[model samples]
Target chain A: MANIKGAVVVNKERCKGCDLCVAACPCQVLALQPTEVNDKGYHYAFMQNPDACIGCASCGLVCPDGCITVYKVKL
Target chain B: MDINEIIKPENMVYTKPRLMNDNPMHYCPGCSHGVVHKLIAEVIDEMGIEEETIGIAPVGCAVFAYNYLDIDWIEAAHGRAPAIASAVKRLNPKKMVFTYQGDGDLAAIGTAETIHACNRGENIAIIFINNGIYGMTGGQMAPTTLEGMKTSTCPYGRNVALNGYPLRIAELVERVDGTCYVTRQSVHTPASIRKAKKAIRLAFENAMAGKGTSLVEIVSTCNSGWKMSPVKANKWMEENMFAKYPMGDLKNV
Candidate 1:
């Protein structure tokens, strides 16, 4: 079996920038933008290192705002 | 397929629950109530009971639960959610009724109604959020506050002599003979979130199966009220709160 890859779509507008998803990520793929803020003035989580994700969905699982959607691809 | 192509619905491993409305929640960043709300919406959608579920929104931070959830809801007076949920379940036997309450609402304001409804074996699920402080009203000491926890009301930590001990509401309700399922769970991490979601499913199932009362107490956190970041609040909960209100099933009959 080949390696599994993953991607995450963050609903920036709805994200409250709670940082739960950023901490829940196992691959260190997510982070809060230090200089950018959404319309709500919150620094929402974003996939800073998209290549490191392994489709674990850990970020999505712990997201309080339910703003992270996980997608997986099997090679 | 390219990673871009994997973003399609077929490759999606997880997304927001359908029952969760598109409205942005009003909860503060890292508020535990949002996770619980998401879990409830996921459970209701997975069970295919969106229309048959009626949520009783307690008068607290989660009073706007109806707006976030795409289901019917009833607003109850402060600490009166259990009584309202009992009536809703009794009147609509086929409906899956549940009350979303906070520590101040459940353990303090609605103590009598909660115990009596549970004692009477009302076929309704109760979702309790125990953050140990009144999050909505500016962080006042609640009935579930820890022994030495500081809040607006108890600025110098809770004094047992003046405020009495923190009530273990789950322990008290589990022994009431009316509750069929009683569990204390949290959503600080991925593993705990899954467990809490399962607990919610079980409680909802019990409510729909004509079983007795089921209470799922979520030992949550109020990052804004606690004066800590979301991550620090979760760590504090795991350290301070878990020792007092340990997670896992207190009673499952």
Candidate 2:
């Protein structure tokens, strides 16, 4: 596999904190903020290990909210 | 390249589907409808058929599908989406027409319409969302609900003697001669999402090719109605729903 890193931009306002994306991530890079809640009073997903992300976008594809955007950089 | 530099549009790897607007979906958290909607938008966008596509919205939670997807839509009465789609397809045979319906809308109410549309070989597609219970109606036991599944109406759990068996609509439609494709899929996981998208793409292509009816059954989860967290709901569906209604293609031609 090519050496690549990934990042995600989550739209907090739309996120329902379903944790589907968090579970779908192969690298376990995402998790719902335990204390913080969005305007909708839902805990949104955020990258816990951004560097571990592979840019595979498994989280984005599995996201029900369509709020997560993925970016990749080749090493 | 650094992460910041790669964050530019040119370096973007994946984003939301173009057809899916920024308007927030009304579905509950972890609802399968959003994922399925995104898949449909991606399929239509990828196929470049947005202009020549018409969707029929059902009288269920997905009745607002027209608002979500920027496309021509016809609001059909309860259990009449297939009938509406049939007419739309016949009139504009070149356009891709499909229906978005839930278990209550398709299996319970629209059963005859769905059956006849498939049996007649209408050049249309049906996206059936079977979550077992009537989500919009407050967790009532639907025709597709498991025998022992509990719902608002069935507080004591579904009794086979009191209620009929869970309807296997996909398999039932598979037996119809007119149906060209029939598949049962779920979108809880990334891999399954991809497969479901592929199945939908094939179904859309089938409709475009005038191949006969293509029914894509999405065995979904109603987290709110099921009174479980999204994660637990998915797990419950995988364990319980999958047992009653297994995944994979029932018929593909």
Candidate 3:
């Protein structure tokens, strides 16, 4: 099974590609890239690297779409 | 593949990228200015108005809003976003025009300009972020700062006898004859954020339909000014700020 620790998971469906999450994340783990359309017909924000997440939840907090989730190791 | 599937957060990264790589933002942590910018960008993206929309960025924390929003934005004089919005819409009626301003810029210095713009029934969307205190200029007192609140300039707490009561811009703006829709909502909670997005989307739709000027005032928070952490700031906003600036649609055409 994947350890899935310190990973940032984006709902993609709820993402609005506003970049607010990117701006909020202090670790710079998030970046905007035109990829696929969500149910809203807009591009969703994605994580540049899931391993870089510090799980500060700043991305989740600032996301207007409520589409981000930051998980940390059980340590 | 499915539109519903596409609306997920992971997918929203680049469907409508424009500006944001350059320029610097001056807002502090937990400031709702960024959220407001995101909502506006979402509205533009969903409405397909990016190419034709022109934004007027006001002074205050929103001074750098143009940097984040991909559409063509013109920096307006302090509190003059509405005046510039008026001129821009008049010049190109077909184009979607909007002004993003903060309480300090709108209610304080730009009150006359904003009031007249709405009174004239200008076709535009006005996104007003009211974080109580002025986020920029080091959290100074703004016209909308609550009574008994302490700011940089009002460290002893604002005296109603001296500063008077806080100004409710959303309520005041609703009374304007030309404003079609005016609503005040908070962004501290998920439910409120969703509601704000809906209201904002409606405002844009209203303007796009040529209904008239629509304004959505988001009751935001400035953690730095309120002297609270991000989480504490959100909670404090719910407890203290909500009573002063009640949320809901004040008017709609």
Candidate 4:
């Protein structure tokens, strides 16, 4: 299978740490980083495993705040 | 290749809808209102109707819906969105009009307005968000509260005998003579979100075509109101809520 790398950009300020994106990610590529807090004092979601993302946009789709953006590239 | 070069516009798959404002939403974390609001903005952007579109905001959690969408909006009295939207549509027949209402505002206090508007077949779209409980009022039991569902008001769980059965507004509206399209959807999953966006787009198109009243009920979740995590709330909604309010088209005339 061709390598399909994906990337996700999270607008940390906009994210309320709802973690809906973490649950919606099918590949388990997302996680709410506990160590880092954004300006909003929330532990926002991060792409813990970017290579595993399939660019499904599931995380972005379920996000209430429109905080996550997804991109893909064929390698 | 530079990382910046790879992150070009052509590589973008998904981003926030342009019609949505940059202001942070006041919705609770994991609240379905934000997702539904984004969908509405996307529909308006896709249809290029922002200029002619007028939204009627209800007096619920979505009362500030006007703040999120960059369009003309009128804050209607509680449950009076449909009545106001009807007037707007009648005065500006060429413009697109819609009402964003919650279960408490639509299925309860606005029940008569909702039914009469549909019965008259007003040329407007109604985006109904049915999260079962009244989230704005601290999760009180609503007209659409599921049987045996426990809310703040119904601490012992809703009893059909006293609270009455959960109103199936979509189905009821579908049966109305003037309704041209009616569908129940959700935004929990990607596929469901796509379907919902399609339904919303169709509702807008129907309104522009003057087909009749189009009602799209989004069976949503209230994680904070439900006293559960966002993830659990979605699962609970899928298992419990969907049973009473199945997702699909009730009518497409």
Candidate 5:
């Protein structure tokens, strides 16, 4: 497979930490940061492995709060 | 690579809809209302009707819909969104009007308003979120609650003989002559959201074209109300709720 780099930007404060986007990510590229808490007191999702993201936008699509934004680059 | 460079317009794949205000939604984590709200905002923005659109907010968990979507909104009494939307559409025929309602508001108290509006062929759209339970009221059984489904009120599972059967609102509304389009969709997955967005866009277009009433029923999940995690709620909905409500276009004309 071609090495494609992907990036995900999560609006840290807006995320409710529902974790729906974490489950929706096909590449297992997202995870809820256990140590970090947002203003909402929830462990928001973060990019654990950005390079694996395919820019499928699945996370953004399933996010209820529109907190996730995805970007990709083909190397 | 710097995250900033990746987020530049040229590399962007998806961004929040501009029509959606920056206000954080109050819905429970993983509630379907937020996804549906985003889809509606996207449709309104894509249609360029943000300036000429009015939304009727219902008295459910989504009562704050107007707060999230930066559009003209009128807060309606419980179950009165359809009626309010009817009046709004009539007085402002050129403006695109819609009602955002939940199963409790729509199928219970607002049932009459809903059927009457559709039967009258009102030029408006109805976004019906059928999660089968009254989330704001502590997960009480709603008119559309599936049989054997356990809820706060129905702690031992819904009894069909006592609670009656679940109301298939979309199917019922589709039979009404005034309805131009009706579809049941979900927002659990990427493909589904795209399909739902298209359905919403079409419903709006139909309303603007004076094609009578358009009802889009979204079979959604209320994780907080369902007493399940967001992921499990979605799985349960797909396996159980979809069997009863099903998904797809029930009517299009």
Candidate 6:
């Protein structure tokens, strides 16, 4: 089976929830959630699909806050 | 820490540096300057030039760029970012230098400084934020204000017979021989934001690599000055400003 493991990680405290990263991700793996607040009192977004991540790194490239990380798992 | 396992849409960790701190920016809510600021910070972070960089803030809405960008900064006297950047770089040739300016500051009163800096080919990065109106000074008519565009100074839509057409600063600067890289991008949406960041990073990288003066003109929105919502402001820029200042690389020498 064609498969990749691992997931994307985000630093909650630094995320501004701007959604720029969400918009840049091609796999629709990032989303700005209304749930959770960072230290700065801003509602930080959470990643939804870690396994679906292709590790293209576009999220990291476009995130204004540098709060996103994508990793590929070797099974 | 499964770092990757804990990954969800909201918890993704980005590799770009968050140079912009938590300080509240002085720009109005709907101002395009905020977007431009974010774009610049993102670019600086991606280029890894934040630590050894000095940025000059102009006298318009972009004057407070220092507050948003976490880097060594110097405030210029209204539209003189190029001049200040020129001096700062000349004094410390090893450091990367940049200037953030607006239409009112760059194309209007500071025209001479901008032209000469580019003409002299000072090795500096210039982030030109063009929103067309004099945002800080109560939405006054600026040199780049579009024809038939109403501003405080031109209450009844700019008249070409009176104010002439909008000044295309990017085109004018591209004609100068000293300017090695010049590109105009917009920051109205995510896709455009990506493009803007690429352009800005390239400008910074070019200067850091000892290239000649590099300029990135960002077509931004001035919601407060334009008397429109942030979303509408983006729309207005797409409809009006884009026609006046089409996005693309003007000169990449």
lDDT score for candidate 3 against the true structure: 0.76
lDDT of 4 by residue, B111-178 (tens): 99999999999999999999999999899999899999999999999999998999999989988899
Residue range with the least summed lDDT across 10 consecutive positions in model 3 chain B:
B13-22
| TM-score pick, better of 1 and 2 | 1
Residues B67-174 of candidate 6 have per-residue lDDT tens digits of 877899999897778988999899999899998888889999999999999999999998888889999889999999999998998999999998888999889989
B1-253 per-residue lDDT for model 5 (tens digits): 6666667778888878888889978899999999999999999998898899999999999999989999999999999999999999999999999999999999999999999999999999999999999999899999999999999899999999899999999999999999999999998888998999999999999999999999999999999999999999999999999999999999999
> Candidate 3 at residue A61, lDDT?
54
CAPRI grade of model 3? incorrect
Using DockQ as the measure, what is the rank order of every candidate, best first? 1, 5, 2, 4, 6, 3
TM-score of each: 0.98, 0.97, 0.75, 0.97, 0.98, 0.77
lDDT of 1 by residue, B15-119 (tens): 888888888888998899888998999999999998899999999999999999999999999999999998998899999999999998999989999999999
lDDT of 4 at B227: 92
Give the alpha-carbon lDDT of every model.
Answer: 0.92, 0.92, 0.76, 0.92, 0.92, 0.78
Question: Candidate 6 recovers what fraction of true contacts?
Answer: 0.25
Worst 10 residues of 6 chain A by lDDT: A1-10
| Model 6 misplaced stretches (Cα beyond 4 Å) | A1-75, B1-17
Q: Model 2: what is its DockQ?
A: 0.81
Model 3: fnat (fraction of native contacts): 0.05
CA shift of A7, model 5, Å: 0.6
Q: Model 5 off-target regions past 4 Å?
A: A1-3, B1-4
For candidate 6, lDDT tens digit of each residue in A1-75? Answer: 135544666777766665656656777777766666776766666668654666666666545444556665444
Clashes of each: 0, 0, 29, 0, 0, 22
- What TM-score, to 2 decimals, does candidate 2 have? 0.97
Residue B108, model 6, lDDT: 93
Better of 3 and 4 by DockQ: 4
